[model samples]
Target: MKSRFLIALALSALSFSAFAHVGEAHDHGGFLTGFVHPITGLDHLAAMLAVGVWSAMTTRRLWIAPLSFAALLLGGALLAQSGIAFPAIEPMIAASMLVVGLLLAAQVKLPEAAGAVLVGAFALFHGAAHGQELADGSALAGMVAGTALLHTAGIAIGLGFRRANQWLPRLAGAAVALMGLNMGWSLIAG
Candidate 1:
């Protein structure tokens, strides 16, 4: 079972290459383009889900977790759009995945405020990446909605499998952390 899960996570991480970039071929400002950006990136998707899962596992205030992530994610996106430079944005993004995954796996239960701040910080990286792709307000809106939906999915997964088997989330978190190491290595190696 563990082997199978690892295989699946590997396969999913392989899709990171398809992540949308600024000035890509289809780089038009629109809803669908922005909507697909978050989901397309394995790092982003995993981190988002991990945050949601961690929130659900640790707190009954499930809604608060996603809300905090999305709000701050939007803020980061806006900051990115303003042509502001955030050094090591890429590394931060990958690290967010690793940390969030670890948190989920560890099942650490932080205070709600601390949890919000944690996710908010992670969101900045993700939002910056998002800003690069979305050049228009509509696109930004779509991306925000899409991110919310992803959070919902993560929350569902976290809540869904939590009671069935606590190990499931931990396993998923470990896989995400491995993916983060891979991403970080690629950044350094490249």
Candidate 2:
């Protein structure tokens, strides 16, 4: 238990450090840039993986939540490209990460549609961020594919964690939740 907690703490610190330096949000373009974008932001990584973790923890339809997230994420990207601004996107995205962490920690259960809606909403903010990067054509394709890969990774982690001892999952969830809180606070404080 002590070792697990220490590992979680180290991971949380690493995640926080990863997001501390942001040169520009629009620095990503092309296939490689788009592919790497999701991992670049700590909040985004947490949110995406949390969705997978939540879905795995639940007994509902797993694929629906992720698919809905992807489709609506595309819509959000298009909306952003159309010159529409969702002013609270940054904070909201941060909030999504925070909420995802909370849900994971709590192991909350909901019906399929509700879960879909939850993840779908978060996906919009994520997609909007991608759109802000102005990625097009191959770049957009790469991002979508990359996102799917991230979701896959999340699912794998969720499954693997479930198979592990109980405390590890909770520890990981708590770590993610704390990171989300820190991320939100830093953004709001700044």
Candidate 3:
């Protein structure tokens, strides 16, 4: 138990450090950049991980939310690539973290369709925000693959914590939520 708490604390602390790089410029032309983007950005990382945790908590289906998120994320990127305008994408991305983080912390269970729609909606914003920067086909594929990996990690952690200590995942969720709130405030303040 002590070790688990320590691990969670370390993750929470690392998340804060990771959050500092949200808007830094990265080479946007390759698979490596797309792959590294989400893991390096706390806003995307927390939201994606929360989606997986929430999906794991559901009783019906495990893949629906993640699939919905991935598909819609791609669609959003496509829309952006095609020159479609999506206003306030950054704010929406931050909001995704807050909303998803709260849902994960509460362990909210929704019908699969509702879950898909909810996750998908926020996913569009995330997709658009990054999509504008990703112009390469391989980069898009890399982003999708990287996102899928994060979802898998979240699901695994969710399942493991479910059997070991229920509060641990919830604690992680709260930390994510707090990070989201901080992110949102920074956007507003700056």
| lDDT, candidate 3, at 107 | 83
| TM-scores vs. true structure, each candidate | 0.88, 0.86, 0.87
Q: How much is 40 displaced in model 3, in angstroms?
A: 1.5
Model 2 per-residue lDDT tens digits across residues 58-142: 7456777777777777777778777777667776676777777777778778888998998899888778877777457566766
Point to the candidate with the largest TM-score.
1
* Sequence-dependent TM-score of model 2: 0.86
Per-residue lDDT tens digits for candidate 3, residues 132-187, read 77868889888898999999988887787778677766777777777777777777
Clashing pairs in model 3, backbone N/Cα/C closer than 3 A? none
Q: lDDT values of the candidates?
A: 0.78, 0.72, 0.78
Higher-scoring candidate on lDDT, 2 or 3: 3
Which 10 residues in a row give candidate 3 its minimum summed lDDT?
A: 17-26
Off by over 4 Å in 1: 1-27
Superposition error at 46 for model 2 (Å) = 1.5
